[model samples]
Target chain A: MNARKRLQFGVAVAALMLAGAAGAAPVKVGMITTLSGGGAGLGIDTRDGFMLALKQAGDAASEVELLVEDDQQKPDIAVQIADKMIQSDQVDLLTGIVWSNLAMAVVPAATAQGKFYLSTNAAPSALAGAGCDPKYFAVSYQNDNMHEAAGAYAKKAGIGKVFIMAPNYPAGQDSLTGFKRFYDGEITNEVYTQVGQTDYAAEIAQIRNSGADAVFFFLPGGMGIAFMKQYAESGVDIPLIGPAFSFSQDILPAAGDAALGVMNGANWSKDLDNPANATFVEGFETEYGRLPSLYAAQGYDTANLLLSAMSKADITDADAFRAALAEADFDSVRGKFSFGPNQHPIQDFYIREVVKEGDVLTNKIVEPVLTDHADAYAADCKM
Target chain B: MLLVAEQALNGLQYGMMLFLMAAGLTLVFGVMGLINLAHGSLYMVGAFACAWIAAATGWFWLGLLASLIAAAAAGALIEILVIRRLYSRDHLDQVLATFALILVFSEGTRWLFGSFPLYLSLPPALTGAVTLPGGLQYPLFRLVIILVGGAVAVGLWLMITRTRLGIRIRAGEADREMIAALGVDISRLYTIVFALGAALAGLAGALVGSIQSVQVGMGEPVLILAFVTVVIGGIGSIKGALIGALLVGMTDTLGKALLPGVLARFMDASSANTIGASLASMLIYILMAVVLILRPQGLFGARA
Candidate 1:
């Protein structure tokens, strides 16, 4: 109650208030990804990439806490993880979803909470179009973007009577849809099997019987391995084509010789020749002792993008930080990346073939499908 | 017709694989009355063990043997430590506890093996393709699987029907307390049964691992299908499990192969595709539903 004590207290309070007024609290970003099951190969790589970038970026602005949870590759679990992150973790930003269904389940919740969501992967078209949210941004391209590029490449390669197969799911439909969009040739047979199917011998038989000149499949994860292995063993001479998923580094080792000469398209490849990518590829291999998959590349870029946005923004201001992210002013391993109006990535897609470079097998660049191609749903996105 | 025959063979192979998993499940259930949701975890263990051993020794036979022994050991350890206490507990308690075990096993596997999938190579003897009567060139490995499955079916039947241990198992299933009173060492029997079931599951996982990517939680989808098979065949009945597995497998494989083409005749390609894919995906479930309707206790249910 003394005069001197009261004055000191007043000064201390004022200083604390000034500090609070000058900058925002420490930024917290939540990530939900699969840490188990078939998708774990991609999910864990993504986690390592993001964490590495975060560490390289130095101390968290105001002490950034990255809250991470495992979706476990289930939709219900994904939703629960999202809810827990939003409510318990109290993360102001959310990112990291590799599966399209999981992304679709998580995005609306983040956006409705006024949180910025940076999608590391999984770019369903609806989000880019009618379902777009101003606060949501994708560090990776839309789901269909890679497949669309594959279709265009197939057309250019003079492939005809292509038999298309995909898992019978929404994302599967999107992949085939994307492929068919640019492929104006005759599709001999379009088959959709149950999601997570192991044996594709029956479908392969059907394809062989149909006399299709080539095959385009969208089998991802373990399904890809099983199908490619079986297809190769069946001695079918038809050229097999698909997106990066069916023949990625994570899958190729399992597919073994079956993966040789398999053509696909992707946004990022181990062999991409950009300086940023070269650094990433080298650093990832040295750190992890394995070649980085596309998932890892996207994950690394996601964290880097966030850091770039943070450096650009007054870290204390949430609105400014969100705005900076929306602008997407960052160098990406994919060479170039910019956010379209729908907050999804507008990037290049490359046609790649599995080839042996010395002792190691990796994707070799065959052609570029599109340069700075925007997503098809951008115009539909009112935002 | 060739496609149909090939697809039917695919179904048979898939069903036999299911029988391998389901037989173990039904054995554990029929004798011990334990739900053991962690059965899938055991399958995963078998796969990992096979891949690890095969890579280390460069011997496929040794790897397969290791898978069986590892799986059995794992099953015995689990049964003694955790599952033994759970035998007297409620199904929900068992389900929740086993579910926890699933998380532990999954996390443990990931921690030990990291996230990359392990690949298993086929033995050279079973690596090539064989032409079937229908002019379809099927993988020789798949044919071996079908043949092994048939042999196992006969072997299991002989064991259960003709052997003294089989009689003891049957007696134990009928009256656990009486069998124990007769000095059958019930605990040992239970452990043996559990280990045997786990070994079967492991063998199944090892057989299929070469064809598929061996990874964490890979056992779960197959486990679900096995559950459907057992349910449709009559839970706790070995014969039921066999019949159910084959039926469910054929329905799933053949339905997927033929449904789209059948629909295409009457509808446009796109519409037929949408309908066919949906139906094909649901075919096994539909079969389960039909079985439930016709025989609530299952196809070969003993009078209860």
Candidate 2:
């Protein structure tokens, strides 16, 4: 109650307030990803890779505090997470949704509200084309970008007949369209199975009877695994072509020997010879005790992009930060990586063959399917 | 002719697996009058146990045995701790409780095994193919699944017809209070039936795990189809489950194969193919609706 004591208390409060104002709180990020469901593998890898980048970014990560939440691949939950991030956490940046559906749910709405949304993996055509936003940046290629590479690869292989298969959904439709755009061949058949369909037996029978020389399928996650297993066992040896999601490092081990020799198109691979990629692959393997999938690679690159952008511009300035991200000064694990006019990645697509390196099954880059290719939807964006 | 035969065989294989899952689900539902939604969780448990054990031991058969044991034991434990209380409760409460079990099992398994799908390879003895008559080579593992399912069907039929447990189950279904008054250890009977059903589902999971990706939530899709099979077959009847599964599997497979080409004859291939594919996916549900309308109780369902 004494005057001297009260004076000391006032001084202490002033010092505390001054210190709080002087040293800034860490850069806050909110990540909503599918982590507990069937698609958890993809989301988990993305989160791990993103965190690994933050950790290795040294002092940069020290300034970053990430709040991670599982969306469970549900759009409603993703929206809630985004709302919480924007309202409660007041996050500087938001990222980390694995599925295209989830991204479509989160990105447009989040970015429209003036929060920067950096996509780790899904880049649906809606965002890339006419709906593209300046605040939205896709560190990953468009959904169709890699599949087009597969189609291009098939065309180069001189396959006379190509039977196409995909799940009956928007992405599936995109996959088939992407393939057909580049592939010059006799279309034997185009069959769309139910989404999340595990049994490909009937489809395989159709393929066999169709007399197709090659097959290109877009059945991601467990669908791809099921299809590949059944296809391998069915004794139909026609070359199977799929996008990288089908033959990624995470699911490759589960697809077993069936996935071996299967060809896929990807923007990033575990075995890319670039120094950045080499550091990422080695560090990721050492840290996680498994090879990084393309999803992980995308997550790593997105984090690096965000950090570099943050260093270049004040996070509070939207225009400056967006411009800095567009600069893309960070060394991408994918060599020669850059953003297109639509804010989606413009990167080379490699034809990777699933070959066993020693006892482990992994992808090896065979050849370039498309070099410095931008998505077909980039031109449609008015932005 | 070849495509038809091959498609038919595929249908048969898929149906048998469903029958295995449905038989257990129906038995549990009929005898206990409990609609256990966590049946899928048990399937997932079987798959994870089989995958982990097989990987650790490097023996597929041993893993199969472990799966059956693990699922059965888990089922019995769950029955004792949770399902026993639900048996006296209404279907809604039972549903909610079992639904909770699904989250528990799924998250628990994910915690244990991580999110990556596990691959269970076919045994060496069952690997490769057998050229049937006219050189229609089918994967021997799939053929073995067919054979094993047939044997189980016969074995289940014999057990139901010729065993005391079967008599108790049928008599219990007829009247729960009467069976209880007659000194049937009702709780023990329920546990035994539940464990048996869980075993069947677990066995199905083990058999199908090699052919499909073994991962979390792997069971839900198959479980939904199995429920359809059980309902269309008449919920409590083993024979009905078999018949309904075959119908579903056959319709689903053959429709996917035959509908597209047949529809192509009427319209342009592209639009027809798209319509046919969706229609094909819906064919089973259509079949179920038709059956429900024709016979409310189901094909083999006994008069209530």
Candidate 3:
């Protein structure tokens, strides 16, 4: 009511408003990933790895506001969550889907709406080829990279005849094709089992009779675990090879000794000698009390990439942010990570061997299979 | 000739596993008239219990025993707490309640043991392959499963045909009200039968878990196959379950083994393999439909 008191209040309000206008608002990110069911292990690692990077950034990442949701590995659920995040939450960017099918469902729509979609995993060929968009970035390798590496490895090892198998799905088809692309050997058999098939007795019988010098399979998650266990017991001495999805750290424990001595192709391993990787492996083991898988590495890189872009350009400017992301200036845990023309990763691939490391079964880098390898679909992308 | 024989054995092994699951499901349906969707959850429970105990104790035998006890105990507890209330309810209500129980068990198990799958290694004695007649090298573990499944089938047969509990179960299946009026503790008998069925499913889970990854949803795929077996075999007949399981298993295995090669003769090898594999997955359902068309009440329904 008094003139002096009113003036003081006015001054305080003015100061507060000035301060608020001076500081930038935090960038909002929506992460939808599998956090339940059988695939939860993959999602949990991704979320944890992403969170660890943000935690390490400390004050720098304070401007990031993350909203996480569980997809339960369902495409419809992922789409619904994406819609909610873009419309209601008004997220500036979206990320963190583990499966390619879910990525196909959410990424195209999200990018069309002018939102940057950074994939932590699941880079299907469809999105990498004619479907490539300016705003969509795959922080992981293209789906075929590991399989291609396996094929190249098989060729190098002089395996004359190979038997290949995968689940009956689009990714499965891509997997076999990727392997065959680089492997110039006689394919003894190309078998497609049921998506979630556990019984492989008949398949094993076929493998035994085929007398292939080696076998390559792309059964991911629990399918891989079951196949490995069954194959080990079958007393079939044929060498086994596959992509890293099956032999990842999350699965190696469940697989036990069955996974030992198996060769798998991967874009990165925990033992990769790089300062960024060293810190990540140490921090992840300390925080989560478990070894980090390639999914985790991808998650860490995705977070760092986001952070690097944020430091360079304002997220509100779509063009500036897109250019910043394309720079990929972050020190990736995978050592050498860069984007291809289609915005998918152009990275080195390694052949890893499963070995016992201090009572824990994990992978060690055996040799580099592909150097600066780009995807087969990149040439098809108009972008 | 050798491959055919081996494929047949694989079919038999697969059928035996299906028999364990279908027997339990059919018995629960026949006696209690309850469509228990949570039967698979009990299977998952058995696997988790076995994997956990086996890993902790380093004894596969103890883990197998624990699987049976744990699954039976879980079944008994659920029957008393949730299932008993639904006995008088319609099939839809039983299905809904049991479906809810599946979520509960899955989430509860995930809470106890994290999302990662547990390992259950085969015993060393049963690790390698054994040469059979004509130099057929078969995995000893699978052979053991066949033998064990055979033993259980015989044991179940004797119990059902010759034992007093079996007679009561048969009488209960015929007329529940009459059995209750005859001074049978119908509630207790239902609990016992449910537990027995649960025990069998759990045993299957534990045995199969050694060969497969023992994870949260591991039971679901097998559960679907078991349901198909139950439908193909009349809903209430043990003998029907056995015969139907074998038929389904054989069809699925043989179809997968021979179809691709057969189709390659007509078409290109790649397309033939793809088409044949897809068709092979559908073979069991086709068999079921054919069976249903011929005999509306199923292969061995007492009503027909």
Candidate 4:
């Protein structure tokens, strides 16, 4: 062999040994979450929760570097951030997205390119079933899981002639269908309003006139705040049921006393009695000076999941990392959290009633509607 | 019949709010010949000002007063510092500049008061529901809004036709150079007009704040609808704005309430709902289009 060729080979070997001896590189997690704009409340909580978990990870904090960027709740902007994170920053893991629509836009693309995306909040149905990707995992429940729990609760409560409403969009459609999946009661009416609509006076009037015994709606964020305010003023005095998103701790203050006595379904609540959850809730409330919502719980859990897997296997080794992640060994804030076959949570969903605790509006866990509840779509997922 | 009555009241209340926004927008567009996209920001600023002050002072009336004052001050400052230069410029420049101001106002508001929305409650005197003629129950605050809009409309008509300032405003709208030649201080007139328009918008925002969550981007959606109302009405006509707002508001409210129920008589429930919802959202736009098709300008648009 030529002398120069032998030297080049030797140098390459030395560099490889040096890299191997240094161990795996630090995991770069790029969070493309909503930080500013209308839904910033949810995104801000998610970011705070995720960062808290990482900060409390002790030695694991050194093993991860988070690059947070605000998507401003725009899908096109989310796509751009995802592409840049994948191509430019070359993040090892992508997490902490807030909305389902934004998730549907970026998740498939990010996972298709072989980047692991552990979702903190969004759990679109397509991702849980037919469109499920091996590299993607939802640390949160399926988008419909909580709504289904609400339906189950309504059925148990014998709510007949139910009037339902949601925004006219994919998530909204999913919410209605999910409610109907478990609910066999006679439906008086089902209405869909415009997405991002802030007024519901007309709809409230119809609900008043429909002769329905109960009302269920899936409007989230600002939409929920508007509906609840108007509903209170209309003096309809009907039973109001909804998914937890509308009555979440993050938005409950804005909804005011209007949300009092609203029954919602969710997998986690601040009052959940568990060691991990107690630690998370206390740590979070201490750090952020506010109660962590379901969004925040999901974000904190996502980070802990990544940290747990990182502790087991080097992130550079894709096969080993996937196996470690699928093991689901992390202590989740939502107790008894485990991955379904589709990498979505097979966890308990409880009925939470919004009640005033010492003049502060918050949710209290009423009953466990579904224990170790796996999504209906999990069976449809071949993976 | 009861449903119709209730929906109509809702439409009127919504239309009144729209008029409050559209009137100022049309007035600025007519007199200054400048498209002020940031009119909505003024609305948001007013809402925030009201919410912030109300929360601090614990009095709804005081908050409302401060919101109007703050909005007028903001409008006057913008006219002096930024808007005056764009007075002679084209509509595109005005649109671009005002659009930029929306971002500035939104971001600045966010910087001052974080991204979370603020809640404003109705005054204790006007908080409950009132029963109408046909056993239809409505919020008193909303009824007040409808009445306030009507009073403002009548007041606007009187001011424009009877008062000297109103004559100057009308004259300024007719011809800027001619008004200036007739010994009118054109710049001061523009500032007064701008501030008046802004104050109306602020009042609308403060009034609506009790019903709606006050946030930074709250103004943009209302602004778009205001622009739609302005187009539907004659661009420079207050009477046109009033009529157009009512028409749009009625179409939207009644369509949303009635369409799904009507469609369900023909199709299955869910599909009927899907189509009804889609159409309900587009109903106002469709009305606008029909108005434009029938009258190349608008229902009350002046022929060039």
Best model number under DockQ = 4
How much DockQ does model 1 earn? 0.53
Report fnat in order of the candidates: 0.54, 0.54, 0.61, 0.61
lDDT of 2 by residue, A125-197 (tens): 8888999999988898888888899999998989899999877665777788889899999989888777666
**Global lDDT of each candidate:** 0.84, 0.86, 0.89, 0.88
Model 2 regions more than 4 Å off: A1-26, B259-278
What does the lDDT read for residue B227 in candidate 4? Answer: 90
User: Residue A329's C-alpha lDDT in candidate 4?
Assistant: 98
By TM-score, the best candidate is 4
Error of 1 at B28 (Å): 3.8
CAPRI grade, predicted model 4: medium
Q: Candidate 4 lDDT, tens digit per residue, A188-264? A: 88788776677788888889899998899998777888888888888788889999998988778877787888899
Best first by DockQ, ranked: 4, 3, 1, 2
Docking quality (DockQ) for each candidate: 0.53, 0.51, 0.54, 0.57
Q: Which CAPRI tier for candidate 3? A: medium
Better of 1 and 4 by TM-score: 4
**Tens digits of per-residue lDDT for model 1, B185-268:** 999999998998899899889988878768888889888988898889886788988999999889877876788899988885
In candidate 4 the C-alpha lDDT for residue A85 amounts to 95
Stretches > 4 Å off in candidate 4:
A1-23, B264-274, B301-303
Interface RMSD for candidates 1 onward, in order: 2.3, 2.5, 2.3, 1.9
Judging by lDDT against the true structure, name the best candidate: 3
RMSD of each: 3.6, 2.9, 3.0, 3.5
Q: Report the Cα lDDT for residue B242, model 4.
A: 96
